[model samples]
Target: MDRITLAFWSLVIGLCGATAFFVTGIYGQQATQQQREAKLESGDLVQLVKVIDGDTVVVSKEGQPNATVRLLGIKTLESKHGKDEVAVYGRAAEEALKRLVGDKPLRVLLNTPPRDRHGRTIATLYAGDQDIGLGLISQGHALVYSVYPFASMPVYLQAQTTARANNLGLWGDPEVSAKAEAMINEWARQGS
Candidate 1:
C-alpha cells in the first residue's frame, strides 16, 4: 500500500478504537448505575452478629464478608469521640439497638448505592416483625434523620413524633425538664 494510504488507514483505525472505548465506558457506567438501582430494590436476610451503635449494625450473609449496615433515616448519639466523652443518650441508643437486634436475624432492605463511603451497607433493617429504625425512634433512643433519599424518612419521622408526644424513653425523663434540648446538646457536644 502507498505510505499516505497506510497512514490514513492507521488514523481511521485509531479513531475507531477511541470511539469504541468511549462508547464502552458510557455503557459500563450506565450498566453499573442500573445494577445499583436493582440492588436497592432487593432485600437480603442476614444474621446480626454485632451492634456497632444505635444506627449501625454488622450482619453476616452466607458466603460473604460481614457487611456493616448503617440504618436509614435515624441518627443515634455518639458513643465515642477522639477526646470528647460519650454523649448522654449514646449508651441508651446502643443498648436499645442491642435489645432489638443483637445476635438476631435481620432483614436488610437496601437503598440506592448499597454501600456508603465508609463501606457500610445503607439499609432499612428489620428484626422479626419490627422495623429497627422505627423501633429506635419510637423508643426515643434515636432521632429521625431525614437526609435526602433515605427510604423510610416519613415513617421514621412519624414514629419519632409519636414517641416524643407520648414521652417515651429520653422524652419521659422528667428530671431533664427540656428532654429534646438536653439530648440535642449532648449529641452536639459528643458529635455523633
Candidate 2:
C-alpha cells in the first residue's frame, strides 16, 4: 500500500479510538446518575458507619451497598479536604456531630435530586424524626448551608440563629464564627 494511504488509515483508526473513549465516558456518567436515582428511590435506612467530615458520613443499609451521605442544609469547616484550605474548628465540628448522633440508622429524606454533583446523597438525615442538620447547627458546628435548593432552609437558619444567640460551640470562637457567618451570608445570597 502507498505511504499516503497508510497514513490516512492510521489517522482514521486514531479518530475511531478517541470517539469510542468519549462515548464510553458519557455512558459511564449516565449509568452513575441512574444508580444514584435508584438508591434514592429505595428509601433504605442506613446505619452510620463513620463520619467522613463535619458534613459527610458513610452509611450502610439492608439490601443496598454502603454509600456516603452529605448532610443537608449545613456546611461545616473543612477538616481533611487536602492541603488547599483548612478551617479552624473543622475537627471540633466532626466530633460534635459524632457525639450528637451516636450509633443509629439514619432515615434518609430525599429533598430534591438524589445526589449532588459529586455523586453523594444530598438529603436530610433523621434520627427518629429529629433532623440531624438542625442538631449540628444548634450546636454551632455547622452553618446553614443555603447555597442550594433545600426544604429545610428556614429551619436550619433558625437553628443557626439560636446557636449564635447563646454563643454555642463554634459560635464561641469569634474568629471562626465570623468567617462561617460570612460564608453563610454568601450562600444565602447565592440561593436567593
Q: Model-by-model lDDT, in order? A: 0.73, 0.79
| lDDT tens readout by residue for model 1, 1-192 | 999999999999999999999999987886565444323234677887777877887777776556667887777868765433335566788888888876667777877777776556688888887898899999988887644436567787788778889988766765532755665557556553
Off by over 4 Å in 1: 1-41, 81-86, 173-192
RMSD of each: 10.5, 4.5
Q: By summed lDDT, which 10 consecutive residues of candidate 1 come out lowest? A: 33-42
Candidate with best TM-score: 2
Clashes of each: 0, 0
Which residue window of length 10 is worst by lDDT in model 2?
Answer: 34-43
- Candidate 2 segments whose C-alpha is farther than 4 A from its true place: 1-38, 81-88
* TM-scores for all predictions: 0.65, 0.76
Residue pairs clashing in model 2 are none
Full-model lDDT, candidate 1: 0.73
